[model samples]
Target: MDTTQLLKGVLDLAVLAVLKDEDGYGYDILRRLRTAGLDEVGDASVYGTLRRLFQAGLLNTYVVPSEEGPHRKYYGLNAAGRDQLNRAGKTWRNFASTMDALLDERGVAA
Candidate 1:
């Protein structure tokens, strides 16, 4: 299975989950996700997801000044984002369990 492809489907959920803890700028969120084990997530993909989520009203963004560079746009989870995360989390748990069972069955059969 292509983990990267799978991750693409859940990238929005991942982004929202990260923002649920606190507001973060684009690069900051990307770094946090990478440090949390999503090493294969790309910068552009993360940035794009942020924009999309913001547009969809799931995220609220604000500007924070930076000493060494341009002001950064920080994102935080809105009420909708939080609700989405909760729903997605449930779906993911169920899907993961189903996949685990199927994989175990395949292993035994093999």
Candidate 2:
């Protein structure tokens, strides 16, 4: 699979999942995603996702002063975000399981 394409589909979920652990600024979130094996996640895409999620009211942002550079805008999940994550996670699980079953059936036929 083209990882970039796959990442694009799940970027929102991935971002929300990361924030579930702790709040992070844009660059920090990008670093965490890369470290977590999403090396193909682009800077622009992540930033854009942050902005969209914030505007959608799924995330809350706050600015924090940086010692070495400009202030960073940190993102954290709010109540609505948690609800969305839960719903999305359940949907993903169901979809994945259905796909798995189909693939398994195909393998058996093959």
Candidate 3:
């Protein structure tokens, strides 16, 4: 399966989930996603997602200066973002369970 397509569908949810407990900048968020096993996630895609989420008012952003090169714009979940994350998480779990059961019935191996 082409996981990129899968990633496209769930990227928003994944991003929101990662930021639920902590805030991070673009590169940091991308790194966290990759470290969490989403190695195929593209930097551009993650950055774009962040922009869209911010524009949609689902995220809050603030700048923090960095000595390395430039100021970093960090993103964190607002109340709307947290609400979205919770709803999406439940939807994902139910969909996954349905798929798992369907595959099991077909005798597909995990």
Candidate 4:
């Protein structure tokens, strides 16, 4: 299966989940996702998702000065984002369960 296609459907959820634990700048978030095993995740995808989530009012953004280089904009979840993450997580769990059952049955029944 093409994991990129699968990731597209859940990018919002994945981003929200990443911010659930801590705030992160765009590159930091992208790195965290990659470190967590989503090596195929696109840099543009994470940047776009951060912009979208901020616009949607699910995330809060603030800029921090960097003595070494350019300033960094960090994103953190607000109340709406937490609510969204909770709902999306439940939905994902349900969908994954059904898919797992179907796949398991197919293997045994074949």
After superposition on all C-alphas, the RMSD of every candidate to the true structure, in Å, is 2.0, 2.1, 0.5, 1.9
Error of 1 at 71 (Å): 0.4
lDDT of 4 at 12: 95
Rate residue 69 of model 1 by lDDT: 95
Q: What lDDT score belongs to each candidate, Candidate 1 first?
A: 0.92, 0.94, 0.97, 0.94
Q: Model 4, residue 46: displacement in angstroms?
A: 0.5
The window of 10 residues in a row where model 3 has the poorest summed lDDT is 1-10
Candidate 2 has an lDDT of 0.94
Candidate 1 lDDT over 1-110, as tens digits, reads 46898989899989988988899999999999999899999999999999999999999989989999999999999999999999999999999899889989889553
> Backbone clash tally for model 2?
0
Quick one: ranking by TM-score, best first? 3, 4, 2, 1
Candidate 4, residues 1-110, lDDT tens digits: the string is 58999998999999999999999999999999999888899999999999998999999999999998999999999999999999999999999999889989889553
TM-score of each candidate?
0.93, 0.93, 0.98, 0.95
For TM-score, candidate 1 versus 3, the one ahead is: 3
Task: Please list all clashing residue pairs in model 4, or write none if there are none.
Answer: none
What are the runs in model 3 whose C-alpha is more than 4 Å off?
A: none
What TM-score does model 2 achieve against the real structure? Answer: 0.93
Q: How many pairs collide in each candidate, listed in order?
A: 0, 0, 0, 0
**lDDT of candidate model 4 versus the reference:** 0.94
lDDT of 2 by residue, 1-110 (tens): 57778789899999999999799999999999999999999999999999999999999999999999999999999999999999999988999899889989889552
Alpha carbon RMSD to native, model 2: 2.1
| Stronger candidate by TM-score (1 vs 4) | 4
Q: Write candidate 3's Cα lDDT for 22-106 as tens digits.
A: 9999999999999999999999999999999999999999999999999999999999999999999999999999999999999
